[model samples]
Target: MSKALDANNRRWSTLVWGSIPVVLLAGALTVDHIPGTDVRLTVPYAAEGPGPTFDTLGEVDGEPVVDIQGADTEDTGGHLNMTTVSVRTNMTLGQALGRWIATDDTIVPVEQILPPDLGEDEVREFNQQAFVASEASATVAAMHYLDRPTTVVVHDVVEGAASAGILHPADRITAIAGKEVSTPSEVQDAVRAKTPGESIEITVERDNEPHHETVELGENPHEAGQAMLGILMTSEPAGGVTVNYNLNDIGGPSAGMMFSLAVIDKLTPGALTGGTFVAGTGTIDDDGEVGPIGGITHKIRGAEEAGAELFLAPAGNCDAVKRVHTDHMTVAKVDNLPEAVAAMEDFAAGRDVPTC
Candidate 1:
């Protein structure tokens, strides 16, 4: 009898604990799925909460129209401030069901369905996962596109960097620190031989005329005991190999996807834009593959608010993204730009978008 009672008690405890989530889930689903109801809830920890999508007051094609600003723009909608319901549902399913079941309609809401606003604990976790996934995809694409580093010949020196003026983007450095160079490796070796605060003369050719400029090196960047010039050099694509990339004003590691796409698009023919205002956030590789991004749901909400007709997301985020989808926008899950482009074309043609 005692053993039976103990087993019964354990069963009751399990039933009580398990029912909490089930009941909450059911209630939330019932409310969210119903019609003539607004599922407006506050996301406390969200970076930018729901608001207008317009980032800047600008014009495209010289026509007066709103333009989306760079990713760094502060025009993002309002962020969730606290862990509370900012507004109540117009007709919550939970409340409606309870009203139908009894004379007195009293519905008890879930205790912790959503996280705290700006919840660093949870947001940090999500960022960590997102960055890891993005890094892996970026690594793969870079390896494919930048397979072998090539050298570019400096032809002109309009500005003398370290000597007097700026170095033009197209100018090539033939030799550094008085060393003969034909490849990028040789230039690097010559530069590496000099110590910080030392002056090095870089030889270059402009219009078949050779010239030299002396520059003082700066302290090591990021790591100690190393030397740097604090400037990036570029050259023509050698060996018939080319690279394409997309860049934005927001300079961070997160722009990997845009950079990759920009590079690939330059290498390929035609423009990616079909004359539509489509904004996206994701990491791209050198191979022109699209990868997952962080804060996708928030991004989706932002896209919808911006009047975007379609959204392209990573395949891995499809399931989670689907759960948060609204009828106001279309989300297309894809592993690369090719798939994403196809989806965009379909959406343009008024075809039904496939869900993840």
Candidate 2:
């Protein structure tokens, strides 16, 4: 009788512990069966929770995750972990119900992740591509942040296009609207943010001298009504300084910030964390601008699981992060790479860490 009462008490304790997430997940639960007779019904929702993290400053499979060549590398210590979210999709009803009461992970419509229009493999491919692109951007971003020589030059300006004579071929594009740009995609993304006929200031270096042009955007030849600069730009990293990322099966651009931090740590003299464990997530650009990412809470939990002392969150996710309750980790809001580095420095020096 006592054993049975203890079991009942434990069950109720768990239910109370996870009651909030249970209530949250109950609404999104829907049937999306895969025609399997083994299970009663499969839920269409996907669960996203903490996934395995990697220390970018450390080794993976006996190789440094961030391998920098032709430069003096720092002998770094502690963790500069990049967090990931473990996703559970196409779950059976039994699994879904168990998860609701067992974990604090979030469940959402599967279509939000794996859209109906694309297959899982295709989506994975796109994610991997984004990861590669972000890695390239992070490499140059770190270089640019360190004031190393990097260039984003106009390969060609399309004839009769918006930037026809406004942007000359071989012109080294410096910044877009005062924001430093070191990649062609940043230039493209900046232009795409505006509509046709919108004017933008494009700073460039022609004949090794500073210049700026205010050019009116033109409609994209491919996507109607969208803005285009009509100038093809190419990025070149600092010569002989190559960065190679050596982790696999991890997809998405969310690791961009951590990767940049790793690169910066490696090239610089002192470790950013100063032997302190740190974990963070943000999509960073070649301009060192940090952007928000999904699964913030999940990544936070992952960082905590790895015993991280500090959590570096993007300023854009301040509202969301402020809602979370953490036990011991110090959460700091960083707007860009410089801010992130400063946060780490502050934490290392035993200073009062900033929070959202």
Name the top lDDT candidate.
2
Cα lDDT of model 1 by residue, 83-125, tens digit: 1011122344554554436522223332222233635346546
* TM per candidate: 0.36, 0.72
lDDT of 1: 0.49
**RMSD (Å) of each candidate, 1 decimal:** 15.6, 9.9
Candidate 1, poorest ten consecutive residues by summed lDDT: 78-87
Q: How many backbone clashes does candidate 1 have?
A: 18
